[model samples]
Target: MFLPNPDAEFTGSYERCGLTLKEYQELIKLSLDSRTFLVKQSKQSAFAKLDLYGFKDEMVFLSGSSDNIELLHEIMADYGEDVNQWYQPFTSRIRHIRAMKSQSQYHTQTQTDVFEIA
Candidate 1:
């Protein structure tokens, strides 16, 4: 699971989902060349998050710049399979996703030399 407060509330709609910086760049290049590009965002947001990162792809929630049509289409991978959901903050936690066997309510050390006792 993506850690560092994985509990952050997020929408499950891929319509307004995020795209990695690289993906955005690629989208721009394609647009400049007048080409259409598609992204793998059909899966539910929750599952897609896992799938995207699981496949070693980075995500970037670029809805903040949706005002610009170029930016919106750049990051939008799909039209969404369902009604739009509330916008979710791009909390930015791409470094915590990993392959593990099980998960539970637990905490990890903040530092190897020193630990936060709270």
Candidate 2:
């Protein structure tokens, strides 16, 4: 699910399929620490509020990051399972993700609200 992070300045998370919250958070941290998003800026930082979810018989990853939110959203929007589809943009800038319940034609708000509004 798309959980709000109270610790970090910006909220983000990327959970792996079939893993617990702690495990997925660790993996996301590892990926972020090692993965560089902006070469001009400091090396990639970590994501926040990592969690897990499932669709049908298989599990899917859910995560958020200021640098990678759009990427994550695009990935889920295009390739993620429909039942498990979910995304919540923190703002017009940063995006958040969880599990989606609906797939109808809808317009997203510019707020950090992390729920679907049709």
**Which candidate comes out best when scored by TM-score?**
1
Against the true structure, what is each candidate's TM-score? Answer: 0.19, 0.16
- Candidate 1, residues 10-51, lDDT tens digits: the string is 344221456443443443443223324434444412211112
Which candidate has the highest lDDT of all? Answer: 2
Any residue pairs clashing in model 2, and if so which?
12-48, 12-64, 13-63, 13-64, 14-63, 85-100, 86-100
- Which pairs clash in the backbone of model 1? 18-60, 19-60
Q: Rate the local accuracy (lDDT) of all candidates.
A: 0.32, 0.36
Regions more than 4 Å wrong, model 1: 1-16, 42-118
Q: So what's the TM-score on candidate 1?
A: 0.19
Clashes of each: 2, 7
Q: Candidate 2's residue-wise lDDT over 29-111, tens digit each?
A: 44333432211113333434323333321232233335455555665666574534533322212312222312221233333
